[model samples]
Target chain A: MPKTLEIRKLHVEIEGREIIKGVDLTVSTGEIHAIMGPNGSGKSTLSYSILGHPDYAVTQGEVLFDGENVLDMKPDERAAKGLFLAFQYPVEVPGVTLASFLRTAVNSIRKKQARWGGQPLKEISAIEFYKRLEEKMNLLQMDPSFAQRYLNEGFSGGEKKRAEILQMAMLGPSIAILDETDSGLDIDALRIVSDGVNALYGPDVGLLVITHYQRILRYVQPQFVHVLVDGRIALSGGPELAEQLEEHGYDWVKDQLGESAVTRQNG
Target chain B: MANALNFNRREGYLEKYGFHDKNSYVYRTEKGVSSRIVEEISGLKGEPEWMRNFRLRSYGIFEKKSMPGWGADLSGLRFDDLYYYVKPSDKKGRNWDEVPEKVKLTFERLGIPEAERKYLAGVEAQYDSESVYSSLKGIWEKLGVIFCSTDEALKKYPDIVRQYFGTVIPPGDNKFAALNSAVWSGGSFIYVPAGVKVEIPLQAYFRINAESAGQFERTLIIAEPGSFVHYVEGCTAPVYSTNSLHSAVVEIVVKEGARVRYTSIQNWSDNVYNLVTKRAFAYKDATMEWLDGNLGSKVTMKYPSIYLMEKGARGEVLSIAYAGNGQHQDAGGKAVHIAPYTSSRIVSKSISKGTGRSSYRGLVHVRKGAHHVKSKVRCDALLLDDRARSDTYPVMEINEDEVDIGHEATVSKVGDEQLFYLTSRGLTEEEATAVIVSGFIEPIVKQLPMEYAIELNRLIELEMEGSVG
Candidate 1:
């Protein structure tokens, strides 16, 4: 059986206002899907709802991960089921070294896996963990000193993106939703981060890359692209759709959809 | 299921160390204080005529002084309901095996002996009103270091003890200091000779095992010229329905080219009032540091102070406090610069959960003639819930035109974004909160010894459990 993440008729609200209005999507192992949209299109809200953020209320939705209803699970429980979300703007937790944070997250997930009758994930020794971390850092072109710095504290924009990719690579999730991972990166950083994400591609994992630009799609190809307009997917097509949107811009899509696709941005 | 997360189980984490036995003490004094009681205590100890007069004067001051009008609420404190003195054993023991069985069992449960064997150069275990077991390593003794109880030091090294006692912190400085001086009992006395350095830390453990008891331990430390020493003290007590009182006075002297570091961790029961006065006097080219951690108590009001009396002297205070339900930790630091080229730094961190309140009350003073002086003070507080409270009261008095002073403070709540970020990385809410809190205090926690740092982390984790939404 293949691992899958299915979001069915998802409706999310924040503070009594609906943000994600009846969106439907499904991602399976070995597939790459991209949700392309402009600002205020509810792309970030959909990702946050899938990850079970406390601020986002799922009024009517069912997120299934590996055939289990993940909407009823806590964020950590959902994460343990191999569902990862790469935040657009990662938080800065001072005094917690990146190495220590990664070790704790890995051990927590491993502990849950052991409870479900798989191989017991013994605690990783410090030396072994450091060896693995060094290898991942090298692949991402991150300096070794980054491992000892506080998690995302005072990190440059490019370093934060690379650190997120580094975490995704080390965690090896079954399905990952990258929410605007290329938002604040320059050309050099974009290529390094795109390459890091591509290097982690395998048949055992699935990827969902959400973005507003076609710039990163050039380096990391996506098989399918969906244009999210007004809290719904207005159009879905092959990789050529992203190229069309890049040339014509999201205004063309809104014009084509006409009065039915008026986007509303709320604070 | 929101109710499941808000179960209010703060007491379970601390209940393990709150067991008490009612009839364990050998002798107990009547409730309340008077000149007669002070005279009786001094006469019982066979103290010198000067010391006896000093006690009488302190008693008079304690009676005349009024209760403090600021800080934590002391309306519930009933002086007439507390036993002013309680002796748990007949005499101080030279060896652990010679201590009374009941007192020995308490220290065993607290793991004093095991800690002493592993990392300490000397150990003193005090129960109730006096030191029950005291020992110093032979190597430090061979180097002419004096490590003993305050009472023993008064009897054997009277010249040195009399020279430094009450010099740094006078009894009339505060109401609690006067009370502690009048009824002071077993505390550590340390002396490091000139040009000598003691590598390992000397440890002292204080326990209050009797109900409605008052424990007043007076500690004095003298670091001679060109010497260095580090002293650590830890306190705990059993739970009681009625409140107990703990008022200690600690004075330290640092001579020219000398250095001294004093570290204290207080985890009293919920029914104990911890009001302490600690001060140090540093001469020319001397340095002093105080690392204080307050974790448990009903109410605590302590602000460790340092007086720079000569040029090129330095002082530092790094303090942390945690206040849970029905607890108040009003603690901070004070630095007084009286001479030229003196410097100081104060860093305070506090956390409040449930209905607890944590306050930072501090002072930084630079006298008129203190030229080229520098000082910095920083205070940070974290409120875990809406009901929890925190406050910062900082006073800086600089009369010198050439002096530099800087102060910064921040109050922050646990952000939803930070929690979501950590939980999305596979950590439970409790675990995520613990990680954030430990990270918040890591700057000061990292400065502690390895064992103490580990214990502090564990304590924070326990405090974070069942504290999540």
Candidate 2:
């Protein structure tokens, strides 16, 4: 089941600079949450912190992915636990093909689960896997030929995001974090990627969409919208908050919680 | 303790690669190379004007060159005691059954026959001085692709052989290159036609079947314009009471829009000195990739390198080495960007155990005119035992300001967490170590042709068997 991805007093530091400071948010199963803010508002850091990115260290706080603290786990471990972070800039692993990488990542999760005293896993053969992968690629509107290509190598902006969604579809993680996947996308590609995410969105999977604009939010409606400013949640409301923030800009939140006050709250 | 030690020792890649019995070589030259033997080898190989001239010219270069003062020390090399060229057997055989008993028995243990039956487009089995089996069947040979021994290439296709043999790596390039050129014998010579892509991999296996011998091989691979070829070399030397020398020179040329992947998995014995030189050149829009693995040997100095000669060209080197006991593997890569928009990468991984020493020495150079050139170099080393040593010396000569270059290296031991993760999965100490070691070298291993890759995995596992604490 898609348990709530709850962040409580979450503090994170990237390269010794405290980025995500005292942030609190909750998204239930079947709910879509969006975090929007300015350039240095720690939106991406929050997503990275929750997914246990090696750079973003959780100095003090807890991210509960299904009531279990994710800080103690490695990035791959968190990923295996159905915690997915669609990177703002997906890494390019040149030699590993998309198929082999996904297969290995999935199999690693299965193998890790086997190590965790979980039930044994039976992996599908390549023939069966290719059929399913082709379907997922079609669902994501990805060209089928990309399946054999190297993971994210020389991929366009839209294709990289689609590949990320394809990985999410294959892994079928419980909580999906899309970190600015909407950036550099033509509206058509934005719709296709958002639709792909929406198609993956069900009661069993929760969604956390971080964006610089509400363009993607228009396609995938969010039940919860939080304004992240200066590393903390400055404003929290329903999807209407996104519309309001988009219209008024983060200026409304900036007025209430200025720079000094924000740092003080962080401290 | 005796029973435990036996079990541990049986678990290493050493046994798989070291299964051959020691045999006394017919003859050996002095410790270092010289000019007289160059004439002797030319006379022995039976005589050709151009061939003899190349050797004599290369011998001149060798005489003029000095031993390299960097990387691994070659002070202990006894060139006269090394059999420069040893054809202990009669002639090159085309089948396994026809091969000499010693050569056949050696590869039988290394699983060459099985790999030939299953994977491999063609297998060139070279035991010490010459190939015992060189076979490329119907469509492959019909494709106008010449996949044969270097000696055969010199005799059969002299024009192609003389044209690009020393272009990428000339005899005067380095001391070892000159040495290899003077008395080079068994090695691969592949020429894929333009627009031809060899789907299956072509492999060459080199074995040091003699004690106190030297293997000087010159491999020339030319992937013509728009063509592609993946050539792999697997080597293993038998344990000898005395030291030996395995010096090789490999030159690969990737013509315009062509691609060439060269992979090597070398695990020589503890007494062998493996000093090899490998270099490749990539033209406009071409790509060259080198995947080299170094395991055994008392001391080794090898750098499988590439030169991006034209614009929009790319070069990459992924290398992994494991040094155990009295071994010292000094291996890395080099990349030179001569034209605009050239990209290159150098990744080196190594593990040192027992009293072994491993070092990653590399250079990445971008010429003044090379604009928009991108390069990244990463070297990581792991020490498995207390007395083990690992070092990295990387030199980046960047004359171009428009290029982007990044270099990072890490040196550490096997982490307790990684071992615990594998051990907790029900693997014993050796199994856990084997898994982690293979994973550490997975980047380079993945590039090998599947059969050789599996054999390499097995060989590494065998080598690490008794190594764990």
Candidate 3:
């Protein structure tokens, strides 16, 4: 069976205020799907809800990963099921070197996989880990010194994005959700980070690129593009849809969906 | 992930080190302190007449003094219901095989002998009120280095022992210091001759096996001119229902051009009140460093101090504290610059979980005529929950015009975003919090020895087991 993630009629609310109101999407291995929407259009909320953030309560909906309901799973459990989310703003954890953090994460996911009748991932030795980490860092164009620094601490915008992609490469997730990863980057940094993401794309992983603009889409092409308006996918089409939305803003989608779209978008 | 995600039911994590055996004491003093108890302790040791008179005078001062009015609350302490001294064995053993069976079993469980065989150049094990086992490597003995019990040192090297015993920390220093002066025993006394350096660390392990017992050990280390020595002390006590008291006075003297480093890790059980006074004096061109870690104890009030008494002297203190469930850790450092060109640095990290509280109370003083002195103090505290609390009280008194002083403090709660980031990477909530905490204290933990650094991290993880939801 192929790996897949299906979000059905997802309704999410944080602090009693519904943000993601009735959203549906599906992604499969070896496919790339981009969800484009304006700011506050629930794109990030959908991504966070998929990852099982405790604050984002699923009021009414179900999320399935590989045909199993992941709605009740914890964040780490969701991660163990080969689900990854690239946060818009990565958290800074001081005192923990990047090398140690990545090692723990890799070992944790390996343990989870071993429990599911998969081949046990042997604990990587320090030399092997350093070699692999160096290879990944080189591919991502990150400095070697980053392995000793605290995770995401005192990092620039481009460094953080590259670090996120570096983790994606190390974890080898089946499905990855990139939430507004292109928001805070210059053109040069945007190109480097997009290239790093593109390098990790293969037949074993599916990608869900969530962004408001089509800038990152130019570097890393998406197979399918969906216009998210009023917490719902109002229009869906090929990669040209992203260029159309970029040229004609979100007003075109709101116009096509009439008064209800405008009311829900503002609401 | 069977054992990987076993954070929810940490049934035996913290209690692994809390095992204790039945009390079997050879000699025990009556409850509380007085001139009679002091005289009895002095007479038992058969000390010199002047030493007996000194104890009597110190006892008078202790009787007149009062409990401190600041830091942790000690109002619940019952002085009348505690034994001042309890000897576990009749005599000190020069070898591990000669030690008593029960006491030897306790040390074996604590891994003292293993550690001694591995890296320590000298080892001293203090059970209750006296050193039960003590030994020094032959190489150090050939180098004119003296490592023995304080009582033995007072008898063999009386001139050197009496010269610097109370000079660094006088008997009238504070209430706990006065109490320690009157009835102190069992602590390590080390002396390094001029131009001699001990390569490996000297270790002392203190254990309180009896219930409601007070272990007052007095340690004095003297590094002669151009000498070097590193002394490490570790402490732990078995779990007891009733409270116990641990009041110690450690005085170190670093002579001209000498260097000394003192590292201590105190992990007394929650039923112990750890009130200690430790200070060092650095003469011209000398250096002193103190690495202190406080993980256990119901309430602890200890602030290691350094007095830079001459030009070109330096001092440093790196301290870390962890307070869990019903524990209060009030620990910090102090530095006083009394001469020109003296420098000092102090860094402190603390974590408070459950309903525990941690406070950093430090002082830095630059006395008059002390010119071109530089000092910096940094304190960081992490609270695991909303109920946990932390406080920082730093005082800087600079009386000179050409001195430089700096201080920085931060108190933070574990962020939800940080937890989410770590959990998203497949780490459990408890593991994520532990990672964050270890990172927070990495600056100070890195300064510890390899074995101790690992143990400190493990202890912090055990304390952080149920801290996350």
Model 3 DockQ (Cα-based): 0.79
Shift of residue B223 alpha carbon in model 1, Å: 0.8
DockQ ranking of the models? 3, 1, 2
Q: Write the per-residue lDDT of candidate 3 for residues B96-177, one digit (tens) a residue.
A: 4443454444334344445432112111243322333223456678999888778878999999888887888888999889
Candidates' RMSD to native: 5.3, 10.2, 4.9
Question: Whose TM-score is higher: candidate 1's or candidate 2's?
Answer: 1
Per-residue lDDT of candidate 2, residues B376-461 (tens digit): 99998878878999999899999989988999998866665444323322234565566556656767777676767777777676
- Residue B308 CA displacement from its true place in model 1, Å: 1.1
| Interface RMSD, candidates in the order listed | 0.6, 8.5, 0.6
Q: Give the TM-scores of the predictions, in the order they appear.
A: 0.90, 0.59, 0.89
Candidate 1: where are CA atoms >4 Å away? A115-121, A258-267, B1-15, B90-136, B205-214, B235-243
Question: On a 0 to 100 scale, what is the lDDT of residue B134 in model 2?
Answer: 34
What's the TM-score of chain A alone for every prediction? Answer: 0.94, 0.93, 0.94
Q: 2 or 3: which has the higher DockQ?
A: 3
Off by over 4 Å in 2: A1-267, B1-33, B91-136, B205-214, B235-243
Docking class of 2: incorrect
